[model samples]
Target: MRRRRGLTEEERELWSRVAASAQAMHPARPEMPAALTPPPREPVVAPKSLAKAFRVGEKARPRTGHDLAPPIGEGLAALPVVMDRKAHRNMVRGKLEPEAKLDLHGMTLAQAHPELIHFVLTAQDRGHRLILVITGKGKPGRDDDPVPQRMGVLRHQVPHWLRLPPLGAVVMQVTEAHLKHGGAGAYYIYLRRLR
Candidate 1:
């Protein structure tokens, strides 16, 4: 008979040992015990006042907390305007002569605020009708979202700031400048000449 090619004495002994050990080991099972279940998630609770503050479909009342009137000329009035980069260049290059101009580059919001107030007052004193304020195109920074306070901060805040005590008398209206100024980046401040 031909010799069979199979496990040698050492191999056969090792295989038997492994088989016996596996048989003695605990069998694998499908079910997990109840104690191993994950803990239940807690429900989120909102504040009572916030939950009841605004309901769906509720009509919002006009905010009366602060005065909404413009500083001068019976309140803010709409004016014809244009906002374009090319037009801004023409306006700045003196190719187009606006009534007046104020540049706010390299100025922080705090610095610009007081300066703007003073400039408007001076322009009004000088009897300048239309003044251009160049706040520059707002730059997006490292934050995930755009800066909450930007040139738009100036655009929106300037009107409100003007409505305050002293500056209000000089500023009749404030609107986005024509393309000749800086467009949305700039503003055309209309003033009432001091009597």
Candidate 2:
């Protein structure tokens, strides 16, 4: 069995003095005061300059030029009246015949524009009343973006372009052909015969 050596009398007295000093130096901390609670926060208010800066009102004036016109007369002169889809349907539905068709299914906006203009002129020259243009419904190609060559590009743009000065005189009316002819992707162009 192992025996631990005992401290000398002087050493024991020194430890007792240290223990008393420690107890006196560090008395227990008192409970926190209730008055030390955080003060209530005040509501925020924006400065007058900032409030005035953010205020909005009606526009100064109405916009003018090509962009202001309806979709049918977008880049064209102001006609007496603009035809809506229903009115256009009535104008071209039974008037167009199958034999006068001009298929432009895969033609790009660039190719189609000039080709369409020329076709209208030629048709007018030949005294053809109804000419069908088949612009196929646009498909989302390689990048998932629409193929402008198909439906979206021409379907919306063609009517606007047809109403322009050069072709307006020759083109009596333009409307989406019936589903049997080609649906929304095709247009039945009715021409005013050359005088």
Candidate 3:
């Protein structure tokens, strides 16, 4: 919820000095036959020009793969506001409440898909302006389970599913629910006006 601040300049300087003078308490050298031992080589150092600058307590290095997507909150926040400004603020702030709600907590992907489609379409037809979709944060697999299992299967998929046709055509805005609702596990769906 809250981020810890990075080290101050004085703290950084102190750390650098401490690190420079520090020696390993116990050096480790594997015992190996002379023939098996590799010859030592000069330590390679990056050219000052090529060295990268970093601050203390920075986030981890960027992930190597391009396949990963941003966090749900970040991705959703980046989307342009597609609904009224006042309503949008109210919805995000938990000031506005949904008229109907659907829970897809226990359903698998195959089962949750159709159920979601029906719920969204029905809500639109009923002239409901806002609704809540609760896809509980996924559960982890049992230790003894033969195959590895992924958790929060529904939490991630539901948003993507809402953007597809049969539902996307009727949906206007989709945002994370407030604490009063299900928080991360739930979403507040604002439906477009029915024609």
Candidate 4:
């Protein structure tokens, strides 16, 4: 696959303006496609070398908890994945500073998904264990309409992306960050160690 490129400053500015104007116009929402019956699951290919190198244990499995968001659309959110107590404590206390960061401020889901996959893979390869991903809390539409508003789209989508297929292998945990780290607009990604 051709490498996905980050949006330039100019493109970002243009997109922001376009999105704003489009929302202002209050265009009719598109009709939803019919949902098909669920297909058989395909087995995910895990990188054995990396898993061995990371020495991941049973603790790496995603556990059930209150932190999970309910299933939405085609994406299913992982069950409130979390790190060990020490790591979680450090993160909450702002002691475990992120080793890397990714800002997904102006990108749509189409644009952000591939970029997200690439970023996580690269971070894992580089031995980064902690990453902060900023997905801007999306703008809320005018409330006069009877339809429910779509707000903070990525806030719901990012977690789903982290739990799907190949990308899920490298991501050990996903948590909402403190206000200093962007609050509801971002996530802390804990990656499996690299060899």
Which numbered prediction scores highest in lDDT against the true structure?
3
Best by TM-score: 3
Better of 2 and 3 by TM-score: 3
C-alpha TM-scores of all predictions: 0.46, 0.49, 0.61, 0.57
Candidate 4 per-residue lDDT, tens place, 62-101, comes to: 5222323343321323355356878876775567889999
lDDT, candidate 1, 1-195, per-residue tens: 999999899999999999887763677786878899888889999766744567765797753233234422133334332335465445434455557788888677889888987888778778886687787665543333433323234555665776686877776656555565566666666566567
Candidates' lDDT values, in order? Answer: 0.63, 0.65, 0.87, 0.78
Minimal lDDT window, size 10, model 4: 67-76
lDDT for 154 in candidate 1 is 54
Query: Which pairs clash inside model 3?
Result: 138-152
Query: Against the hidden true structure, what lDDT does model 3 obtain?
Result: 0.87
Per-residue C-alpha lDDT of model 3 across residues 1-195, encoded as one tens digit per residue: 999999999999999999999999999877998998789999999767866788876977853322145668677888999999999999999999799999998898999999999999999889999999999877765645555544577988999999999888898998899989999899999999889
List where candidate 1 sits over 4 angstroms from the true fold: 1-97, 145-152
The TM-score, computed over Cα atoms with residue i paired to residue i, of candidate 3 is: 0.61
lDDT of 4: 0.78
Model 1 scores a TM of: 0.46
